[model samples]
Target: MRVRNKPWADDLITENPQAIVLNPEHYRGQWQSRFKSVQPLHVEIGTGKGQFLIGMAVAHPEFNFVGIELQKSVLAAALKQSLPAELPNLQWVLADGQGVNDFFEPREVTQLYLNFSDPWPKTRHEKRRLTYKSFLKSYAEVLGDGGQLQFKTDNRHLFEYSIMSMTSFGLNLTELSLDLHADVAASQGELENIETEYEQKFAAKGQPIYRLVAQFPKK
Candidate 1:
């Protein structure tokens, strides 16, 4: 999907080599310097357009947020929206999410968010799904022990597959919601605001959003 009305695209690409770490080995002990004090980092892989990431960063100013999007054009749009806000807690990178472990140290991230990830419905594309075992292994290595992976999707098959995959990885599941909005009232005050572009669209269509929170066991 090509971005058509991308007004703030250029702003996402950071020319500063210091700010962008393509190789994970270089981050090592110095990763803390990337974000001041390293007060828990949360990463959103495939942060399409930046709506959800931007909102999360704004909502939780205490935690640092990093958005990884492969598409430079859309990444630029996200950057443009984030930069004007001058948010100290928010940062982004234009890179392949499959290589996330290479750029982050063991247990570097506190949380991971996979919102409306590509379903890749075709059987041959199963390997490409973010919740596939291969991707989950990478996330396990990068996320801190006991850290959480929060996922939301409109695809029922993907959601079911993800739950099974997460369980197979030995991750503990805590929260599961088949319909987010309907469960919101019962969830008390723990409702998080909508962040992804697809999330908004799905909500508008009265679709049930499936959500799950899985935690990696302590090593």
Candidate 2:
């Protein structure tokens, strides 16, 4: 997901204060206030280029969507792409996923999404993976009991590692698919699956997309 440095990225981000929330921590426990209506809050970590999140926002207006991306240029791209829509239920945060607990109150988020995140394949770099136990702790705290976490990745090793990490951390796996597109095609497009830019690209190369839906353990 290499994007050419957009020279106007800073200017674009500076111009859109409402859509690109610079002070996300200030909205802790009150995320609904930013939206047109109070509803369930859904967040996507590593929300690269914004296609998946924008589509989700459009399709599920009933839920508030927040995309957190650490890369400023990438976040700016998302901001620029979302400008035309001016979606009231959508917003962007330029921050690291590790600080998720600082951005939202416990149980404030209804669901979380991880799409095509860096696998960090090396054993020594396991902690850097978004699905690592440390990251899962933040996710669980922010989501609380019965909160859902959906992860999608084309990396088989990452998917497998995530399954073990999450389950060992006491999360419950509700749904899983080794080949998501195959199921989608089998279902005749009845299954609801959003395709991210990376997802589309990987799928185009005949890669099997792995996806899983997990829930935080009940109190």
Give the candidate number with the greatest TM-score. 2
lDDT of 1 by residue, 1-219 (tens): 665755445533545433334454566545667776568889899998889988987888899888888886777776766766767777777788888888788888899999999999998999999999999999998896898999999999999999998999899999999998778867686876564789879889989889999999987
> Over the full model, what C-alpha lDDT does candidate 1 score relative to the true structure?
0.82
Question: How big is the positional error of residue 53 in model 2, measured in Å on the Cα after superposition?
Answer: 0.3
TM per prediction: 0.89, 0.97
RMSD of each candidate relative to the true structure: 2.5, 1.1
Cα shift from native, residue 187, model 2 (Å): 1.9
Give per-residue CA lDDT, model 2, range 159-214, as digits (tens): 99999999999999999999999998898968899899999999999999999999
Could you tell me the TM-score of candidate 1? 0.89
Q: What does the lDDT read for residue 83 in candidate 2?
A: 87
Worst 10 residues of 2 by lDDT: 1-10
Q: Which stretches of model 1 miss by more than 4 angstroms? A: 4-29
